[model samples]
Target chain A: MSEAVLSIRNLTVEIPTRGGILRPVDQINYDINRGEILGIVGESGAGKSMAGNAVIGLLNRPAKITGGEIWLNGTRIDQLEGEDMRRLRGKHIGMVFQDPLTSLNPLLRIGDQLTETMLEHLDISRDKARKRAAAALDEVGIPAAAQRLDSYPHEFSGGMRQRVVIALALCAEPSLIIADEPTTALDVSVQAQIIALLKRLCRDRGTAVMLITHDMGVIAETADRVAVMYAGRLAELGNVRDVVTHPEHPYTDGLMGSTPLASKGLKRLRQISGSMPRLTAMPEGCAFHPRCEFAQDICRAEPRPKLNGGRSACHFPIQQPAEETA
Target chain B: MAMIQVKNLTRIFDVSKPWLNRVIERLPKAMLTAVSDVSFDVEERTVYSLVGESGSGKSTIGKMAVGLLKPTDGSVLINDIDLSRETDGGKLDKARSDIQMIFQDPYASLNPRWRVREIINEPVSARGGNVVGLAEKLLEQVGLSSLDADKFPHEFSGGQRQRICIARALASEPKLIVCDEPTSALDVSVQAQVLNLMSDLQENLGLTYLFISHDLTVVQHISDKIGVLYLGRLVEEATPDELFENPKHPYSQMLLAAAPKMDGFGREIDPPQGEIPDPINPPTGCAFHPRCPIATAKCSAERPEMRVVRGARVACHLAE
Candidate 1:
């Protein structure tokens, strides 16, 4: 995959709950090449965010990566601890959360936040960091970057505030970014603006992005490759266009059909009848077998079946050759 | 005849601080014209949706529709009963029972301390009716078992809670329900399930809905008639088929184009330009003229009123 910038191999995240040891993310594997946008799509509690968090080593308390390795540019990082991981975070990897306000300190000026992150990672003077911070703001399409440096987060609008957050994330010059629902809080019109800004900035800098979201439309618009997760497992993974138009896994297919965009002229949406299984109550064979429309007797008794490639984990995946012509 | 008629409805929020603070800052009294002179009609048994971004006054309009918030100006007539001017208690009570509301966040709307039974039966018991039998029936009608009435809201998922919200709204036997961003907080798959249930309920019970949301795709899927709002104004109103196929207003066109669609995969879309102006000090004429791609001098100089054009109401100086 042309020297993968980020490679996740056999990743698993576990939580020691009162009921039992809960595996939120189970043995997921994927790769993001330089400048590539890999989108992870799933419903709530699908462990899409957990996998991203595992890569950044920011898993919340009571949840830790129990198995597998995270490789960043030929270096193993998941085993690193404390200061090593902290240093690697701002220097090698950056993160953008759903809420901009949470990532940013409301009391400090936007410029201060950007400069602080930059100075921590790079061997640069305060003056140089200040200049670079302004440049970063301008790069993210923020108007009057020089003057805006003095402005606090409250002074800016929601969309502008998110832009500032992105500028802060980019100021460190990290090779990879983990954006978890970066535009979910933004308005639809403003959402388009932020997505375009992110895409352009990442392209020009050749930085890889791991975009975790529940919106398939966002994935279709921005991602190079798409990975579909269901009940803490990878259901399907392929090129964005193929996965979107012709999903290999039935879960992905049901997800696409459930979206309002795909329900045109249809009386009722093609719905996946039940909710995702609780971690403690996961089904015996396939996690999605209970809701699968094409489920057979074998599907309930056997674990996920291997496809010709690692593109799908379904017992009877949607045939590919027929999809190409249709 | 329209089931609910809102005529020149306007709501203004005084967002200024105390009088002393205004005087100290040498600032005039700040007021936000949330919904300004907006007018529309909801036909019985039909879904009328208001689509717009935040601060466009769609939710404020919804609050006014259900009498949760009184308008600073204009009138709301529900089934010929004017909500503002109704002095007769009997008529006002009937109007209140005929209309109900479903909020955006199912988590916050339902009482945490109350069981599902108490939550659903509030409307029925408020009017001195038997809540036990009605609660059981509503729980089943919303696709949950009658036993679920004894459980708490935390026990259910987001989709199930929304179904409970729907059941509570139906308990009053309301003819009109105001749904404010009902499915926006939900995941796409669960959103579909709830939408399907809502559509079914409408068909079976002859319910009229005022659906408000920011997502154009969901609005298009659920709406019979759709209204596009921007900066407290109804910029366009038309049937979903007519509007989505060919939007008349520039703002409407921009909204349709900017909405991320699954069909046009890998195509680079031109993002919508510019931020929405501050409502406290909005642009003089058309609020959207500053960002409109096809703006003329007339658009900046004077506001455009709604005009009938090709079976739709469009508010743009250049709209034909």
Candidate 2:
């Protein structure tokens, strides 16, 4: 079996509100191997980002990891506290967020940020760290890295700033990367560049990446495996080819059908009937039963199904048509 | 006759530093030609879409078409009446009333302090038109309940707020509506619902739409005609079928190729070269010359005019 770089088992996150206790992420499980890209896809309130925040130990107050285990490289990290988790962040895990400006300090020079990260995590001289910072910029394909080192974050364009963010994330040589909507703010051309850079870096350095995005196309082109989330639970998880080409879960099928494809001719998009259920007002049985087309009396009466050695968490997984399977 | 005619519409913004700063720094005035000599026409009850990346001036053109921003040069004629140059007050008011706009970012577009009823009826009330039961009728027409009229914008979700905006746009019963990225902010499933509603409204009311968006897939699905823009210039225009199947311009081909595909799993593509050029100091001849894969001395020395080629209007010297 391949080495698992990150293993998350039955992870659950809860937030206490005035209305009630909200479980944003509920009983999610997945394993990301070394040098693999695991894409988490869902809608706005689907708790995809909450799961990632829990792994990094960055959950805001009032929101807590109620249950689960997060194992990184064989070490149980869910119980790690502040100082220990801070140390683990730069040295063992790197992050790239949706907005580049928020990640980078606007006042500091690009080189200073990179060198400071390296000096804090790696045992190296300041001079060496500075030199490595320039090389890091070069690796991400920024032109004139050495001269541009003194420039502030505002000096670079949106795409170039994102490249710098990628360099900073990888400067400490972490074993895993958590990129949440990294290309959502970028144009198509620039988005392609960033995706290619992330893919190449993962392959070359054997880094495990947990890429969280709502774009199916990005996941289709980049991920080796995909996990579909709906209403704070794992709807389906499998190989990217199987999940995207033929989704077993009814919700996943509806999502794929709704996304308008450029390759397809003009036609009305197949819309899911209603919006995702809010966390506070979640239904009694399966969270997706109300919106699911395959829901039965059993689905509404029984608790939500667990993956339990199968790919999808549902009462009835869509089977492959005989003709297509043949 | 076309419902909307935009002729040589141009808008230039002064992006230079303030007077004292420019004098101290010995800098010249910087002008950004946001929409440079762009022309297009939308027939009655048809959907015409302008598509490009950020800073490509698609939004600027949409603003010009709606008379929200006066053009530095050229004009926009709606129903044979020039909104910018028409001196008669009665004629200009009537033309303005015939046009309405739907903006992107549903969160920002709707007024939060007012009830949905007042927000929808403001268009009619401001013009001294009777707004009795107008809000409820339009709300029901847009798939929202009549009870929603009493709630504030904060009480609704993103898709619901956009539906309210559509209701407000239709309150005036305008002949043409300009939609700028109406569904870009919504989730995919909700986006499908909103697009379908827009299509139904157009068919029922015989309304024309000038849609501006950065998403190619959504544009291809919704537009009757698509205009591809690059650096404030229209590079190609065609039906979605022709544009997607047989793209003549290199830039159009690159855009279609770069858009992530559903069945493109494990496929490798050579990333397109270079980013969009600075609009202020654009290229000398063709704005796309610097990034064109096939470029020669002629491409850099002379600008290409839009010409009919292979059943599409293409602005490339080597397109033939």
Candidate 3:
């Protein structure tokens, strides 16, 4: 992809705990090109959200980004001051979270929230911002956008509220959007709608997206490229089709096989044995060596393996795709 | 034979404010009909799944099935004994033993203070059954080690806690279990493990399950028969094969279409337009008509009864 909109070079986030220093997001690197959606998928506590938070500078107390650079449009943004980072959030890097109810202010009207963000980001007139908010709402497929803008967040249904949230995110015309589980809270139908809306609006406006989710199906459906994270590290990164259909990492393959697709029939799903290790108890060398089917002695003794072309962290990337193996 | 029979099950929740607040606001008494006239049967040793989004009354129906929540209007029969109408204490106790409930949140379901042994033995101990070695046996049955019986709920992971809950449910030796989104909270891989364990247990022990989940794929995998709910109403019911192959109801079709498929990577999804109508004052006729793609004038005027079409029970006028 040409002209990457968002680039992460060896980003790491560490939290100091009673047990020890917990590295939730270990040195991982990826890029989201202009108008591309990069899916970051992992199980709970795999640091997908932590990575997104580090990018948006929303990490919790004591969980600080320790190493590497976050470049937005060629500008290193990891060390931006508080006010500059806050300004950069709405103007350059908009964020959408899983729950719309929490993201939106229930006391304020949808129009007011949209206009407030727009006015903050862009030096535009109030009338123009209101018109743009209505247009944004319309673009996200909220029916009777102009009138419904006056309604409170509670008045609109869950799906409509998500659409309004998406509109709020898009109203400022951010170059990058970090949508962390944006559709996880919605129904399957509503999830599809929101995903499609996100894809369309982002594509039209050339907005790069960093979609963080645990659902492989969502990543398969919406993502341009996929990054599989395991125990705070990137397990695999490749084209969505290649990574999903032809997974190079054993962990990615396990995820693909575990999903109950209609084509796979009613057979027992391929489950990854044991759960992800807690951050404090993460294994030496490769964090996933304990659960990996292809783990060797080298995996346990060596530092995290870096794959050729930085595509995967597995020491021995599978030559054959998982589908053929299965 | 149907191990569990739900007949016209309805649960109405009074969602209005306090009497004084209501009087001051000039608002009349309000009730939200969470589950309305829902009926289905779980055959002996078969899995019957109820699939729906939130507020579709799926969880309410599940709760009613296991006697956790009493229905406002209808009856849930376990082994042909009416759950709501059972008056005798002895009969109610016997019926309760036959039906066990597995809740959604494993973290909150099990008492944190209680050890796994006590948690699993509660059902057996209540009925004066042999509690000795019961927890150990149940733990082993659910793929956990016997040593785990000594540990507290907080000592285990989310998936392990869910397994403990399953073991506790099984300790009662229930004929039917109402599982309310059993694997939704677990990771995808862990979800598969739990589902596989449940399927294996069902096959080996002839256990019947009234599985409830919003995930279409999980439901499709586990269910022999499936019911699609929309706003407390059953819009479609059919075998998983029949339902997935050809969904008759527009709501069911929309759900199937919107369900994310791994095979369709990079494929653009065309989800149905509109949102779920307000359940308190739902659409004029069909609750799903507002979001349904093939909704007609008749759809908004009169509700369609479940009719047998193409080997499926569908509540849609256009399903021929």
- lDDT tens per residue, model 2, A1-326: 24998999999999988998999999999999999999999999999999999999999999999998999999999999989999999999999999998889999999999999999999999999999999999999999999999999999999999999999999999999999999999999999989999999999999999999999999999999999999999999999999998899999998988898722664677888888998879887778889988889878875678887689998898997788678
**Each model's TM-score?**
0.98, 0.99, 0.96
Model 1 alpha-carbon drift over 4 Å, by segment:
A306-309, A321-326
Q: Compose the digit string of candidate 2's lDDT tens values, residues B94-204.
A: 999989999899999998899999999999999999999999999999999999999999999999999999999999999999999999999988998899899999999
Q: Name the 10 consecutive residues with the lowest summed lDDT in model 3 chain B.
A: B269-278
Binned by DockQ into CAPRI classes (incorrect, acceptable, medium, high), candidate 1 is high
| Model 2 CA lDDT for position A246 | 87
**Which of candidates 1 and 3 is the stronger one according to DockQ?**
1
True contacts kept of each: 0.73, 0.70, 0.82
Better of 1 and 2 by lDDT: 2
Question: Model 2: runs farther than 4 Å from truth?
Answer: A323-326
Chain B structural similarity as TM-score, candidate 3: 0.97
Which candidate order results from sorting by DockQ in descending order?
1, 2, 3
User: How well does model 2 score by local distance difference test?
Assistant: 0.92
